[model samples]
Target: MQETVLFVDDEKSYLAYTTSIFENKGLRILTASSAMEALEIIDQEHVSVVVSDNEMPGMRGLELLAKIKELSPHTVKIMMTGSADLSTALAAINSGEVFRFVVKPWKKSEMLRAVKDGIRRHRILQSLAREDEYILHSLAQTIELKDASTRGHCDRVATLALKIAAELHISVDRQREIKYGSWLHDCGKIGVPEAILNAERALTPKEFDVIKKHTIWGCDVVRKANLSKTVQDIVLYHHERWDGKGYPCGLKGEDTPLEAQIVAVADVCDALTMDRPYRKGLCRDEFLRTIVEMQGTNLAPHLVDTLLQILERD
Candidate 1:
């Protein structure tokens, strides 16, 4: 999304003047007559930078910016007032609410410089986020290349899991974490021998033990990266069953984190639907029947029902 700025000032003349200066400069501007109005716009739109006049009626600039810090913490805030009070400026800076303070009758060059600097800060943050996503997707594709597995296994799992998470009414932040977990659920397989991963025959008892250790290895890998705990849980526990017979950790029932449980169902669904070296993939009708019978045994019963709701809808 492009970086956008909002101007909140009680005086119509100043609001117009602030917006006019940035016109034809590739800057998108939104204006509000009061602090409350500014907040309403913020709630509905993505405002990258907010320049507000402090002495407004109803809600003041500092109070509105404080609320913005809680609501959209990354948005850059600038305090504008005709009077220059060091105390107010200091308070805004110390609280980490305002990025810059501008005096009234400001030089056009000074305001422009401040706004551009704020935009640069926002762009840096956005670029880092994109880089993180690229690294995750690249890592997932590399993992898939190790074994003769389904095409884009991690991507499919993430798509399916996110649909179920949405159906479960999970919060948006958690949904993002779920996506990350889905992509790296089997990351531990990086340590497993390729020969064991591609074996046509059922794994021997000792071989299965090595396979089970992949979860531990993957969790350790994720932990070292300092990822969120939710990501670690999904990597560590995606194989865990609803019954007390999973692996590494035989967590039963709700003992498994919800994010892990969602990814677990998604992983199994993909494995059954896609062709493997040992067996042909199941048709939709057959797969549905088998998984229906598997509810409460191999997977969480409620989560299985949730998955069914998403699949049937699609």
Candidate 2:
């Protein structure tokens, strides 16, 4: 489908002129006479760009731009106004989050150029978001590979967390976040020394302290890398316990992000059921019983029940 652009202006002549210009360029254009009408059009259309005149009767152009930012944050916004005053430009920049500002009596070529640049910037933002997610997943895998015993642990935990998310009927976007969070849940371990990580025996007090630093380290790494806040929180707090006795920050109970808590239960269940260098894997019955016994104490009660139901059906 062709990318759609929405042009909003109280002036019918200007709307007609700009719509014709963009249409000739093989772009799909939707027009609205007022900000309210424009919002309605936006709700019904997949608008990639919004060009709005600043001097409308009901809602001024700057106010319309602010509303657009709230309604469709990803849509590129361009403000067109007769006034080139400092205040108008500042409002467009600060409040409207305008991608470009066009003065009234804009040359057709100038208008076209601004639209093209807005589209390019939107695409660049999208590409950067994808690249950020890729880097996060790569870092997660690297941390998983640090210990031979947990080579596929991240993958398994992510898969299990996604299943639980489905059972809970989470939104598709939230489920995706949970899945990514699960993959990178243990990334803080990258900060722990290899000697402490790979040690076969129970960890010494100092070594354990070093291991615990991984959670803080992981949060710092993500914060520095500018990962999404939700993913960063999950990585930092996945080690927290339901009873409040666990981990680098010792966050407990409902203080943990729900996604992190779900992953924590899945992570522990998988770790217990799968073979580890220190011990043989538990039998299926024992594994199920162990989780059931810990419900409401170690695991979130609802998630524990969901996990057990999954295992039962399988």
TM-score of each: 0.65, 0.67
Best-fitting candidate, measured by TM-score? 2
Residue range 175-271, candidate 1, lDDT tens digits:
7778989999989999989889989889899989999999999999889986768899999999999997998789998999989999999999999
lDDT of 2 by residue, 1-314 (tens): 57678888988999889988886676788889999998877655557788998888989878888776654556799988776464776665775478788888889999999888887777776677688678767877888788888888888998888888888866454565677778887888877887777777788998888877777887787778755666777888888888888886777789888878988888988899887766878998898888888887788888899998887787
Q: Which parts of model 2 are misplaced by more than 4 Å? A: 1-122
* Each model's total of backbone clashes: 0, 0
Instruction: After superposing candidate 1 on the true structure, give the runs of residues whose Cα lies further than 4 Å from its correct spot.
Output: 1-123
User: What TM-score does prediction 1 earn?
Assistant: 0.65
Error of 2 at 49 (Å): 8.1
Worst 10 residues of 1 by lDDT: 67-76
